[model samples]
Target: MRMFDVCIIGGGPAGLKAAIAAGSQGLSVVLMDDADHLGGQLVKQTHMFFGSEQQRAGARGVNIAKELVEQVTSLVNVEVVLCTTALGLYDDLVLTYETEGSYRKLSAKKFIVATGASERMLTFPGNDLPGVYGAGAVQTLMNVYGVKPGNRVLMVGAGNIGLIVSYQLLQAGVEVIAIVEGGPSIGGYLVHASKVRRAGVPILTSHTIKEAVGVNCVEGAIVCELDSQWQPKSGTEQRIDADVICLAVGLSPLTDILWQAECEMVFVPELGGNVAYRDSTMCTSKPHIYVAGDVAGVEEASSAMVEGELAGLCAAKSLGVSGAHLTLQITSARSQLEELRSGPVGDKIRAGLLQAHR
Candidate 1:
């Protein structure tokens, strides 16, 4: 058994920020990630972010991850453990994790869960085919592994992920036949949607994939137009030829640890899926267990980073580590969050947060 002042159960944008915040206060911190490297999904994002200079808006996500990793590694009070999977959060506040087939137990005064979210899968005929992939998987293959997903791709969903990945595919020399969305309009930023459009890709709103046609792999897709109620319209089915069918429908919060801890959970479709009910400080119903990033609610990386810092500051303060500097930092993080969640773009997140906090 081992102990620390703080144990952060992820190494993504949120987890890394939390570790920096908590460890800078001279508290012992352990940051664990199942992958061999940190940065989580940030490592796969090649596109420049959108936000203020403080959030590194113009910087590419890969570069941002590198910078955050460098900062974290310099913190002597923080322990970075990779290839470690957190098994459960016990009632006694002890966390069990597995590393290299060995089980270990650790207890912390505060546990910050930035476990993040997984890409949501779409249901359709032949969805289990080999060439069918989630948007994240495609990003990892193309951006991280330097492997093209396919020669031509059919993208489902016009949300940011769908649009961004489509652009990335085009950059990789893969042909993006078209992007189909079940909704009435594109769900991502106009900037992203416009980028794909200028690249000669069509955006089909109120359209959805009805089935994937293939025997062993996705050879093509059958798509159709949708009515106002989102029901498929017969006789509108169109066959599109593509070697790959990518689904970027959405993401759902990974709150397994929260559920294990019995913290309050709510289903907020606007936020993605089931998420932990967290306060402004990112503290969940369970006092010692805090949540940030997608585990709390699905949002952009900028907001996740801010939430992580807020959670870390609050957790450290609860442990008697506080000063004027910490107070100011906390206030700044909250203000950034509010600003990020402002505007029409944040309407869905704002609605989701209202339900979670309720």
Candidate 2:
């Protein structure tokens, strides 16, 4: 078994920041990610982020990922392990993982779980067809691999992912037919929604995809209006011609390791789904275990980075690394988080955190 002062189970924005904080404090850190590379979803995002300048507002996510990765790699105290999947977290502070068809174990004085969220799939007829893709899948297909998902696309959900992808599809020279949302109003930032709308893609509120019309793959989609109860209104179904149906409904926290560790979990709808209960410091019920990013709650990457810094600072502090700089950094991180979650746009996330915090 390998031993380290800290083990971070993700390499996304959160995990990367966590490793930087802990490693900068002179702690031996191991940052492991299931993917072959670090940066997580940040590498797939092509749009500029929204936040204060301190959070790198106006910077593209891919650029941010590059900067963070550079910082992490330069830290000699931090080890980067890729293509490693954490299987379980034991009570003895040992984590089991699989890499290259072999099982391995590692123990750390403190652990930070930054495993992000998975895209939620919508249940509809023919949703299992070949052309059906998740929002993340679409981003990866276009932004990462530079492949057009299809010529014409029917986007499901009007959230940030849906709106952003719709615009991305247009930029990729694909035709987006329309964006359908079950809610009465758009769910994403107005700026994103306006961009797609300006591209001549209609956003249908109080509407949903009833089915994906196809034999072996998506040939079209059946969309309809929804009533106050969110039930589909009869006679409102309309067929849309498209080869791809992208689902961007929502995301649920990936907390399997937290569950295995026996950390207290709660289902907060606003936060997406079941998430580990954590304090402001991002520490879970288990003293030595911490969570950040979507695993703690589904929020933007900006907040995830702050939460990651907080978790790493607290974890290092718990491990006897202390100084005025560390204290100031922790305080700044907490304040940044609060500022990020203080607006009308953060209402849902603020409510979710209320129910998720210990």
Q: Give all candidate RMSDs, comma-separated.
A: 0.9, 0.8
Error of 2 at 103 (Å): 0.4
By summed lDDT, the worst window of 10 consecutive residues in model 1 runs over: 275-284
Which residue runs of candidate 2 sit more than 4 Å off their true CA positions?
Answer: none
Candidate 1 regions with alpha-carbon error over 4 angstroms: none
For model 2, residues 1-358, the per-residue Cα lDDT tens digits are 8899999999999999999999999999999999999999999878999999988999999999999999999999999999999999987989999999999999998999999999998898899999999999999999989999999999999989899989999999999999999999999999999999988999999999999999988999999999999999999999999999999999999988899899999999999899988887788899889999988888999999988989999999999988899999999999999999999989999999999898
lDDT of 2: 0.94
Please write out the lDDT profile of model 1 over residues 1-358, one tens digit for every residue. Answer: 7889999999999999999999999999999999999999999989999988878899999999999999999999999999999998876879999999999899998999999999888889899999999999999999989999999899999999999999999999999999999999999999999999999999999999999999988899999999999999999999999999999999899988889889989888998899988887788898899999988889999888888888989999999997899999999998899899999999989999999983
What would the TM-score be for candidate 2 when compared with the true structure? 0.99
* Candidate topping lDDT: 2
